[model samples]
Target: MDIELITNILFAMVRSGTPLLLVALGEVVCEKSGVLNLGQEGMMLMGAVTGFIVALTTGSLALGVLAAMLAGVLMSALFGMIALGLRANQVATGLALTIFGAGLSAFIGADFVGKPLVGFAPIAIPVLSDIPVIGPALFQQDILVYLSLVLLVLVWLFFRVTRAGLIVKAIGENPWSAVTLGLPVLRVRWLAVAFGGALAGMGGAYLSLAYTPLWAEGMTAGRGWIALSLVVFASWRIGRILLGAWLFGLASILHLVFQGMGVDMSSNLLATLPYLATIVVLVILSSKQSRIRLMAPMSLGKPFHPAG
Candidate 1:
């Protein structure tokens, strides 16, 4: 369509994609350390509620964001204890985490329903934001938008250039050998889980504090699961995670745009596009299981013990 229309669409994609990008990136890190956290939804919900409450109470968005990250870390640490420390079933513990987060967020956020909170406003870069079509859509965004990109870069660099990054990679590839090398496999996994939790918390906070500026129960609305699938869909690569999140985000926003255009269709059906796309991608990837096996972390989802 027109340049204006195209710009609006691009801007919508960026806005819609940021939270997914954040969550998926965090998950990549978590999975890299051989921990499959199915509790992304729960962690995100906890973050959203905790972040909103802190922001509303203190009138400081930054403090609220910090609180949200802390909440995620605590939730994830619980997962680490059950899955990593106690040597429980990783998949089962993750599923339980999601259920716990949903009920807990509902109970804690029940009182704050319908209350409006100030959200992050866009910060336009002076000269760059004023440029023709690209600037505003790409450059003028809230702090978290930029932070998400920075996090992606950091994650890539962590795996690429740093010694700790190599150690984490080594642990993910073969925990037994990592242990043989005396790399502190359990401790590394715990740190990775905590880091992933923080990023997931940040993602959830971005939703409440920037995207919606309001608190709602189960507001994440399957984005967490979508983020989970995105990690696999990307084949555990950081760049692909970026592309996949935006693709899903664009699909998500299109349903809204369709409704705005007064297209006659079931809204519920339209809303299913993103989830449908996720399933399709998973099926495609699964059909090529050999490729996935090569890309995936060797010990993913398996609990590790030093002696075993």
Candidate 2:
């Protein structure tokens, strides 16, 4: 019931949800472009370990972030190749990618285990951090938090007010029609998948270097999966993604708070809140006709023959 606890909870929601928000943002794009990058979990883990190692050794935050994004891009490209080019199953390919990424991260981080966490420092603008309770929670976060918000707004504009966005949506909606109209469906989708990889990789970097700053084996801790459901929960809208991430963040903090308060709930039950909430949101959202209209590209999970 304390004021700080609620304040801290809000702060924690923003801080914790930043990664999910980023990953969801990219996933929404990818899905809109008709590609489902299920390997987000792997992309994130690889990026996290890569970022942690690079940051620790090079003493450069930028380099660490670049390394993480690179790692994620590489992994996502692999997913794109199998799923997009060779006509493999997106769902299975994504699951395999997750396993591959997790194992690879564990192997890469083996030596880095027990090492100190390396993360970005928080930055507070003048006059912003001094605004009583609102200032500290909102403005006193690391630069990444601010960037996530910026990306959210920018992506929304991209979808709502751009020709390219329309093309991507058209491709997702009807690939054959897009092809007839002379759109580069495959190429555009490939780029979307790659961008999605980079964004999800940034999410990974947040977990290892920015959020917790520790390299744990499989440190993503189901966030990747949660991000996937978030697409449904948010109804594939960037604006709603922010709200979904915050909701998930609240669920996560609630789990911790319950534990601290000695509520005697099973650990597994507590851990299920985020996923459960996502499902509930999806159910509520599905009843709305507006949400159902945004289906993935016609060729999304379908293989692109390109010859027809």
- The estimated TM-scores of all candidates read 0.93, 0.92
Q: Per-model C-alpha lDDT, please? A: 0.89, 0.85
Top TM-score: which candidate number?
A: 1
Off by over 4 Å in 2: 262-271, 281-291, 294-299
**Residue 154 in model 1: lDDT:** 90
- The candidate 2 region of ten consecutive residues with least summed lDDT is 290-299
Q: After superposition, how far is residue 64 of candidate 2 from its true place, in Å?
A: 0.4
Question: Candidate 2, after superposition: displacement of residue 13 in Å?
Answer: 1.1
